[model samples]
Target: MYFTIRPARPADVHGILTADIAAGRTSPADAERFAAGISAAVADPARLVVVAEAHDDANAEGGTGVVGWAKTHHWDYADGPAPAGHYLGGVTVRPEFRRKGLAAQLTEARLHWMWERVEFAWYVVNAHNEASLALHRRWGFREVARGARFHTVAFDGGEGVLLSAARPQA
Candidate 1:
């Protein structure tokens, strides 16, 4: 359960990809496309890909491995005209690591990154995901709008709420 949060590296792509697929967030066929996208993000200085790496006592190399990950980047809302801002996307923690506050740690890291670059942070969550909704609200995000804004998209087919939170002042 001991882990450290750090910026993701190119080598962590497979661990991230495996976690995403295991979480049912993406399919196996999407591996190639996801790898390319992840590679680009890792290389982009403006973007961030953070991962929670757990210490591996069983490994002889004495190195840690990624167990959770979250990324921040610009997302253009296509439903209607809206200001583009930093989007908190792809937040995930492995199943065994759930309820251990890894998600919050990942989110806090993303928010900290946001406060340095933007006035606001945007994210979309499935309406039925009460846990995620509660987490966002607890972190000060308020729903700006909901319904078909994310249509034809992943997970819930665009049936979700659009939420935003002001960047915390330093």
Candidate 2:
């Protein structure tokens, strides 16, 4: 449960992919595309990709590696409510690392980052993903809209809900 959150680096791409696969959010066949996306996010100033690395003393190198990751994208609101703002997506934690609060930590970090850059931000969760929906609500995100037919890299024609939160008062 002891982990550090930081801006993602290119070196963390593999670990991110590993976690995604371990969590059943992605497949090995998508590694190439996922790597490309990670690389692009690392280089894009408008995007925020962060990784949580836990201490791994067993490794011969005696270092930490990525166990979870979350990223935000500049969304134009072409499909959901709100004009244009940052959209939180691609949040995943390794199966073994679940229930340790790492997801909340990563989300808070991204929210803080978005707060300084945008007046509002959005998050999307599958309608069936109760835990995520509850977590977002706990972070002050309110449901703005729900789509009966939603499609994404990980899901197709599924129920999705859009949630929005404003920048916290100073």
Candidate 3:
């Protein structure tokens, strides 16, 4: 499906919350809190939040055109293999839009934003998340460490792998 990947806006917060809820990443009861958090991220000067807005024609399900979202954040882990630097924080795509390159596009947008100021990027993933791992590998992210947690970021019932990749040159 066609989508427009761009920097997120205040109006996009609810769409993001919708995506989060649909992906089972957020509970309906916590929607207000989640929306507030998304607002904060949208307003944060130090964070890069991007969203994939589905084209009107592509959103055949009559849902919000916001089909996916992603963000990059500065991580400072005092006790893990990951150092204080920019990281590819996370992404979420609506179920109907999954496996359609939306995730990669969102990731590319964030990486592009980061590469403007840094030479490297980092990310962490659950060891059991083979799909994400494979995607990161394709982006040239190599393993740096593995453990139950990366400082305060804990993996759910599995090991977490810290990965890093250099900025791609044009």
Candidate 4:
């Protein structure tokens, strides 16, 4: 299965937003805001947003589009582990696209992009998200801390654990 993975463009926003909602990540309203944010990040070199566009099927680029996406924050010292730390979240794949290795491919691409410049990369996952926890583990991320997620659109009083890994070279 071949896919053209690259930083997202504004034209891909609508499709990406649709997949995000279908993946149960956000409501239509939230998807709109999320798309805007992702577009902005993709335009900024310091930030990262990778999308996987399937190439084999005729309906590949439309309808059930944008198989998956990975968003990484630029160095945010206050919200991260170090001065040059990066944080990733909102990693999602369409329900039909799950278990297809799309998420892992997107994740590796994003991590490779940041490894050259960042000291560490980290993400927080809901404790109950077994798939995500397993994925992170496979990618070499380890649990470092835990904290309450004070706000969430899906759940009330949810808590998540911080998982981090040093760049392979470092």
Name the best candidate (by lDDT): 3
Model 2 ranges off by over 4 Å: 56-62, 80-82, 149-157
RMSD of 3: 2.6
Query: What lDDT would candidate 1 get against the real structure?
Result: 0.79
Model 1 misplacement above 4 A? 56-63, 76-81, 150-158
Select the stronger candidate by TM-score from 1 and 4: 1
For residues 53-115, what per-residue lDDT tens digits would candidate 1 score against the true structure? 876567635445678899987755455522466778858888877788889989889888887
lDDT (Cα) of model 3? 0.85
The lowest-lDDT stretch of 10 consecutive residues in candidate 3 is 56-65
Could you give candidate 4's per-residue lDDT for residues 1-170 as a string of tens digits?
56667888878888778878888887986766787787888788887888887766666565345878878875544443223357775688888777878888888888888787776777777778898888777768998766664122133467677778888753
Candidate 1 lDDT for residue 118:
80
Instruction: Report the C-alpha displacement of residue 147, candidate 1, in angstroms.
Output: 2.9
Question: In angstroms, how far off is 148's CA in candidate 3?
Answer: 1.2
State TM-scores per candidate. 0.85, 0.87, 0.90, 0.82
- How much lDDT does each candidate structure score? 0.79, 0.81, 0.85, 0.74
Scored by TM-score, the top model is 3
